[model samples]
Every structure is written in structure tokens, then in C-alpha cells.
Target: MEYMNIINQIIILFLIIIVGFIAGKNKIISQEANVTLSKILLNITLPFLIISAFNFDFSKNMLKTAVTILIISIFVHGTLSIVSLILYKKQEEGVRKVLRFITIFSNCGFIGYPVAGSIYGSEGIFYAAIYNVGFNIFVWTIGILIFQSGNVKGKGLLRKVFINPGIISVSIGMTLFVFSIKLPYVISETIKLIGNITIPLSMIIVGVSLCGTSLKSAFKEGVYYYASFFRLVLVPLVVYFILTLFKFKGIYLGIPLIVSAMPAAANTVTFAQIYNGDVSCATKITIVSTIFSAITLPLMVLLLK
Candidate 1:
């Protein structure tokens, strides 16, 4: 029954993503405008969401569980990230999306947290939050450096990572979590209001980002095959089997699979913009992979049981 509710919640989230895309398609919100919206969500809304999640005093019992989940979730997202990068290198260079895609995108933060939390409780959210922040930092610093080789301004990249609003918010959340401090109500609610906009806004931005692309190309250049197989099929399949071997179950396994399967990180586009790499190719990858996830994610979870 609890799992059913989670499933329903996830379906609703998917509907929201689609609705955002439709909204963009109809010009209810121009895709061009979403770039700024994305910035607002990342820099302002998301971080507050993180802090706002800490509204209650994290009791000692909840703290222990949170700590354990955080540590384990890191291992889950981090390990797969390394493996994905290696596999990414083996693929053709034209598909540069694979390179940036794996390192940066993990649905756990964006999709996984909300989906899993609605189902498994804060334990799911705790793990999902860690993967999103930790994965983002890794990609921004090490991952960006690797993919940034030919393009992007290499100088002061680390500086960019340090000041990233999302990154800064994670640092803030961790501080509050450790000291067990509750933020003031007014500020917390404000953050909550803004933060809640993340998923809906992100989905819409994704639709807007797809504005000028050719959907027909989804099957072109073998991009579709690689994007679908690597992200949806191959990566998660391997992760799924390996996780089962380790006997990790529930949100632990659930979070990684979802994260691993997320469409190429939106950050891929951000990195391309900053680094001047194959932005068009990266954008295409994001669009394609995200569309694929809508189909693949539900199927993957069905296989989980």
C-alpha cells in the first residue's frame, strides 16, 4: 500500500514534467526564458529546499540513520560514476554526451529523492540528497576537468565549483544537520516555497531546452541507441545486478538505479556553455536521455521486484 502511494506520486511527478514540456511547447513559458529559470532554481530554490528539509530538529535516532544512509549512498552513486566514465570513454567521440553525461547526471537528486521519499520516507530522501550533491561536486571539479579538455575556460574552474549555489546550499545543509540546528521559521518556509519549485521548473526547462532540436534525431547517429542503452539499459542493468549481490535493497538500491538512469545531467549543458565544448551535442543528449528515462524508469522499477 505504501509502495503504491509512492508509485502514484512518481506518476504525478512525470505528469508534471510532461506538463512543463507542453507548457513550453505552447509558449505558456518560453523555452528561452527557462534558462534563467533554471539558474534561479539551482542558485536559489534548490539550496533553500535542502535547508528547508531540515526544518525539524533531527532527533538522535533520525540522525544516526541519516548518517549511515549518507555514507552508503555516497558509495552507491560514486562507484557507478567511476564505472560509467570508463564505459563512456570506450564509446565514439561524436557522442561526447556520454563523457559528460555519466559524471554529472544522477536522477537521485532531482527525480529519485522526490520519488523515493514519497514512497520510502525520509530515508529515501536522505540517500537521494547525498547522491545529488556529492555527484554534482565530483562532476563539477573532477568530472568537469576531464570533459573540459578541448573546450570551456579551464582557468578558475574550481572557483566556479566553490561558489556554486547548489554546492553552497549542500554545505549549509550539512552544517545545520551536524549541529542539529533548526532554521528560523520565516526563512525556512521561504526556502521551502522556492525549493519546491525545483522539480516542476526543471522539467519545464528540460522541455524548453528541447525547443530547437530535432526529435527525429533521437534515432539518428546511433545517439538514440547509445543514450538509451548506456543510460537506461546497460548502466542500470549492471548496477542492479551488482547491488543485488551486495544485498543492498529498498531505497539504497532504488536510489542508485534511478540516479544512474537519469537523462544526461542538465549540468552537461551548463558545462558545455561554460567550457565551450559540444553544447549542441550535449543539449541533444540531455533531451534524448530525459525522454528515454520517462519510459525506462517505470520499466526498471517494475523489474526491481
Candidate 2:
């Protein structure tokens, strides 16, 4: 029964994605305006969602869980980094770089928060935020180097890692969580209301992004399936088994598993564009992996039961 609820939630989220697809096809969400919507989601709604997730009363166990999850998040990324590097080393330079980036990062924020919130409520979002702290840290640092070929340097690199929306929002949320500081009722409710916009808005953005790509071309490359298998299946399965072996269970095991199983980060396309990588290849892989995840993610959730 519980697993069925999870499946239902995933189906609903995907239905929203279909709406965005139709909207994109109908020109209801123009490509230019989709970019603006992405900005609003990243800079505004996402941060509020992070902050609002921290509104619960502080507890020692929760704090310990947060710290533990943060460590696991970093460890998972570090190991995946090494694994991805070796896995794709023989591919052409342009395709290799994008493959590594997509393999190492997942769409943990946009899809992660909403799914976590649905499953574990505020506590799920809280831990998802903690897990994402490691994502922001590595993504801006090592992730940038992958595409830039280590050209980015100095204080500029540090600023990008530390000053981005993800890190900043996590810092604010952590501060509130640690101090047990409560916003006034009005402010708290307002933040929650704004944060609620994140789920459908993000899924719609994904749908619109997908609508712009050619389904035939996106799936034509056999390499896209190979990479998606790693990103959506092998990585998460490895993480789940290893963590369960160590006695992690319930949300501790579940949240990380869900995040690991997410599609390639949407930022894969954005970074490929910014870095002059193979933008077409990146888009194809991202779209293909995301489409596959609609099947994989629900299966991942059912494993929790």
C-alpha cells in the first residue's frame, strides 16, 4: 500500500511533465521564457524550499542524521567521480567529458526535493538539502574543471563553489536548523507557500526542455543508453546495497537511493553549452536518461518497502 502511494506520486509528477510538454509544443512556454523560469526556480523557489524544510523543531538525532548524510553524500560523489573517469576514458574527448559530468551528477535538486517531501515530508527535504550540499561543493569545483579543462582558476573558482544558490541556501537552512530559530508564523507560512511552487514548476520546465528535442535523434545513439544505464541504474543499485549492508534503513537509506536514481542533472545541458562541449550530445543523453528515469525512479522507491 505504501509503495502504491509512492507510485501514484511519481505518476502525478510525470503527468505534470506531460502538461509542460504540451505547453511547450503549443508555445505556451516559449524557449526564451523557459530560461527565465529556470532562473526563478533556482534563485528563488528552490532556496525557499530548502529553508522551509528546516522549520522543524531541532533534535539531536536529526542533527546526527544530517551530518551522517552529508558525509555519505560526499563519499558517494567522490567514489562516483573516480568510477566515471575510468569508465569513459576511451571515448572521444568531447563526448567523454559530457558523459563523465552526467554520470557524476544527478538531478537531485529539482526532482529530489519534491519526491523527498512527498515520501518523508519535511524531514525528507531536510536530508535532501544536506545531501545536495556535497553536490554543490563538487559540481562547481571538479565539475567545472571537467568542461573547462582546468582553465577556471583562482578566487573565481572558489567563488563559484561557495557562492552559488545551492551552497547559500544550505548555509541559511543549516543555520536555522542548528539554532532552532523559528521564523514568525506569517513569514514561515509565506516561505512554505512559495516553496510549494517548486515541484510542478520544475517538472514543467523539464517537460518543456524535453519537447524541444527530437525523440528519434535523442535515442539514436547507442552510447546514450550505455551512459543512462550507469547514471540511472548501476550507480544507485550499488549505493543502495552498500548502504543497507551497513545497516542504514528507512529514510536514511531511502533518500540517498532516490537522489542517486535521479536523471542526469539538467545542468548537464547548461554546462555543455557554457563550456563549448558537445551540446547536441549532452542534450541527447540528458533527454534519453530523463525519459528512462520515469520507469526507474518508481522502481527505486518500491525497493524501500
Candidate 3:
């Protein structure tokens, strides 16, 4: 029954994505509108979710767990960076940059929070938020550096890493947790309601992005397949087993695995656009990996659990 429930959760998420795909195909939502939705998600909804997640009472063990998970997450990204370097050593500069970025980062925030909440509720999201601290920090710093190939000359580097919504929420959330601060019940509840919009909105954005892409050409790149396999399957399984070997149990083990298993982040295209990388290649990998994740994620959970 637990296994069935997990599969159902994955199916429900895919169905939501399908809605966005249909909307995109029928011109129900234009690209400009979708961009607006994405901004709302990152700037507003996700931060609320992060704040609400910190409603848990503090404990020494919880702090320890948070730290451990943070370390593991950094290690996971660092190791993937090495793996990507080795695997794509001979590729062209643009392909190498995109491949390295996509392989190193996962869609931990947008997709991860909802799936973790469905399976493990608030506790799941709490850990997801912690894992995301590492993700947000690394992606902004190291990931951006890779994407731009160290083009940090004139960009507001500090603002990009420290002042972004994700890091801001993390900062606020951690402060609340450490101080045992509580918001008014009404305020917390309202934030909770707003945060709930994130899941469907994120999937819809992904689905809409998939609408006009040449799926065949996306798959035509043999390297895309190799990268997808590495992103969707190989790395997550290795991380899961490694965590298990260390005796990390329950949601601790599961949350990281799910986050690790998310397809290439949809932000790949955004980064490509910003850094003048291969936008088409980034889109193909992002869409194809996400489509494949609907199958791979549930299987990872079922087997790992």
C-alpha cells in the first residue's frame, strides 16, 4: 500500500504537468505569462513555503541532522562536478559548461518540496529546505561560475548569491528556527496556503516549456541520453546506497534521494540564456530528463525504501 501510494503521487504530479502541456499547446498560457508564473513561484510562493517549514520546534538532534544533511549535499554536488568533468572532458566548451551545470544541480526546490511534503509532510519539507541551503549556495556561486566560465567581472555577485529569494528564505527560516520564533497562527496559515501553490505552478511551467520543443532533435544528441542517464539514474542510486551504508534512515535518507533524483533543472535554460551557452541543448536536456524522471523517481523510491 505504501508503494502504491508513492506511485500515485508521481502520477498525480505528471497529470498536473500534462495540464500545463495542454495549456501551452492550445495557447491558453503564453510564454510571457508562464515567465510571470515562474517569478511568482521563485519570489513569493517558495519563500513562504520555506518560512512555514521552519514552524517545527527546535531540537539538538534536528540541528545535527540538518548539519549532516548539508554536508552530504555539498559532497554530493562536489562529487558530481568531478564526475561531470571526467565524463565530458573532450566535449566543446558550450556543451561542457551546460553538461557540467545540469549534472551538478537538480530541481530540488521547485519539484522536491511538493513530493517530499506529499510523502513525509512538514518534516520532509524541513529537511528539503535544509538540503536546499546547500543547493542554493552552490548553484549561485560555483554553478554560475561554471556557466559563465568565471565571468564574474561586473555582475552583482553578492546580490545573486546572498539576496536571492531562496537564500533570503533560508536566512529567515534559520533565524526563526534558532530563536524558536513563532508567527501569528493566522499569518502562518496564510503563508501555508500561498506556499501550496508552488507545486502545481512549477509543474505547469515545466510542461508549458515542453510544448514547442523538437523532441526528436532533443533526443538526437547521443550525449543528451548519456547525460540524462547520469542525471536521472546513476547519481541518485549511488547517493542512496552511500547514505544507507552510513545508516541514514527514514526521511533523512529519502529526502536526499528524491532531491538527487530530480531531472535536469528547468533553470538550465535560464542559465543558458544568461551565460550565452547552448540554449537549445539545455532545453532538450531539461525537458527530456524531466519526462524521464516521472518513471525513474518512483522506481528509485520504491527500491530504496
Candidate 4:
């Protein structure tokens, strides 16, 4: 009964995506509009979510565990991304960039947060948020560097990311926490008010973005499917065994496993656009991976539990 309940919860999220898929098929949401929503999520809402995360309670054990897990996972994600790119060396610049993004990035914030929370509750999200801090920074700086190696100026790299509202919000939120600054009851409430819009808005926007894209195009590419296979199954399974070996077990172990297994992020699309990577290919992979994750995620979560 408990296991079936878990599967049912996952189905609810998948159904949300399917609804978006149908809406897109009917021309209810334009790609342009979807992108606009993504910008709002990226620029305004996502940062707020990060800030709220800092305000949550964290034990020393949680902090230490998160730091260790992330350090290992970061290298894994980066290496896989590079390897995937190398495998496709003969492909055009755009297609290579898209695959590289798929390899390196996981949907920790946008998709991972909601699913993790539903499965493991608030504790899961808090740990996932800590993991997000590292992932977001890497995506902005290192990932962008990979994407824009030939075209960008070194002097303005940090500025390009820092000036954005999401990064700024994360900085402010973390700074407040570092100083032991407690947001007054009223003000913290206000930040929470503004921050709450992020998750659903992000999903809806993803739905909107995914509305009209062709899944068939993505399936036609064997390389993209291979990447999905590793992401949705192989990598998480490896992480599971590693966790068991280390004697770090239970919900903490299970949560990060799912977070690790998430599909490619939408931010990858932005990276692809800026760096001359393959936008169509990136979009295709994101669409297909997300769809498959609907099934893969529940199966993994249940087994891990």
C-alpha cells in the first residue's frame, strides 16, 4: 500500500506534463510564450526559491552529508558531460553543446525539488537545495565557459551571471544566513510570499515550452537516447550502490539518488543558444528525457525506499 501510494504521487506529476504536452499539441501555448515564462522563472522566481531554502533549518549532519555528496556528484556530472561531448566529436557545434549540457546538468531545481519534496517531505527539499547551490554555480560559470569558450571575454564572465536577478537573490539569501541574520517575521513572510511562485510556475512554463516540440525528432537520434539511458538509469543505479557501500542509507540516500537521476535542465537550452550548440537537439533531448523520467523516477524511488 505504501509503495503504491508513492507511485501514485509520481503519476500526478507525470500527468501534469502530459497535460502540457496535450495543450501544446492543441496550440494553446506558443513556444515564444513558453520561453518568456522560462525567463521569468530563471530571472525572478528561481532565486527566490534558493533564498527560501537558506532560511530552512539545517543540522550539522545535513550540511556535512550534503557537501560530501555534492563534491562527488559534481565531478561525475562534469565528466559525463565531457565524455558525451567527445563521443559526438563529429557532430555540429550545436548538437555537441546540447549533448554536453545533458551530460553535465540535472534538473535539480525546477523538477527535482518538487518531486523530492513530495517523496521525502521538507527534509528532502532542504538537502536538495544545498545540492542546488553547487549545481547552479557550476552551471552558470563552468558550464557557460564550456559553452562559450571561443566567443566570450574573460573579464566579464562573473558579471554576466552575477548581474542576473536569480544569482543576486541567491547571494543575498545566503549572505543573510551566513551572518545568522534572521529575517524579521514580517519581512521573511514577504520574501516567502514572493518566493512561493517559483515551483509551479516553472513546471507550467516547462509544460508550455514543451507544448509543441516533436518527441519523434529526439528518438531518431541514437546518441540522445543513449544519454537518456545513462541519465535515467545507469548513473542513479551506480549512485545507489555507492551509497550502500558507504553505509549512508535511508531517505537521505534515496533523495539525492532521485535528484541525481533527473533529466536535463531547461537552462541547458539557454546555454545552447548562447554558445552555438544545437538548440533543436537540446530541446529534443530535454523533452524526451523528461518524459522518460516520469517512469524511471518512480521506479527508482520505490526500489530505493
Candidate 2: residue pairs that collide: none
lDDT tens digits, residue span 1-305, model 4: 27777788677767776676666677787777777777777776667666776775545665576677667656556656556656567777767667766767788878887777667665566567666656766677678766776466766766764566555765676566656678889878776776678766767766766755676776788887787887788878877877777786776577668887899876777777777777788788888888788878887887665
Which candidate should be chosen as best, given lDDT against the real structure? Answer: 2
- Candidate 4 wrong stretches, greater than 4 Å: 89-93, 149-151, 160-170, 175-180
lDDT of each: 0.65, 0.91, 0.85, 0.72
Candidates 2 and 3 compared: the better one by TM-score is: 2
Go through the candidates in order and give the clash count of each: 2, 0, 0, 3
Candidate scoring better on lDDT of 2 and 3: 2
**Model 1 CA deviation exceeding 4 Å by range:** 59-94, 97-100, 121-123, 150-155, 303-305
lDDT tens readout by residue for model 2, 66-176 = 999999999999998888778777789999999999999999987888888888888899999999999998898878888998898769889988898888988988888
Instruction: Give the runs in model 3 whose Cα sits over 4 Å from its true position.
Output: none
Better of 2 and 4 by lDDT: 2
Top candidate on TM-score is 2
TM-score for each of the candidates: 0.84, 0.98, 0.95, 0.85
Ranking by TM-score: 2, 3, 4, 1
| Candidate 4's TM-score | 0.85
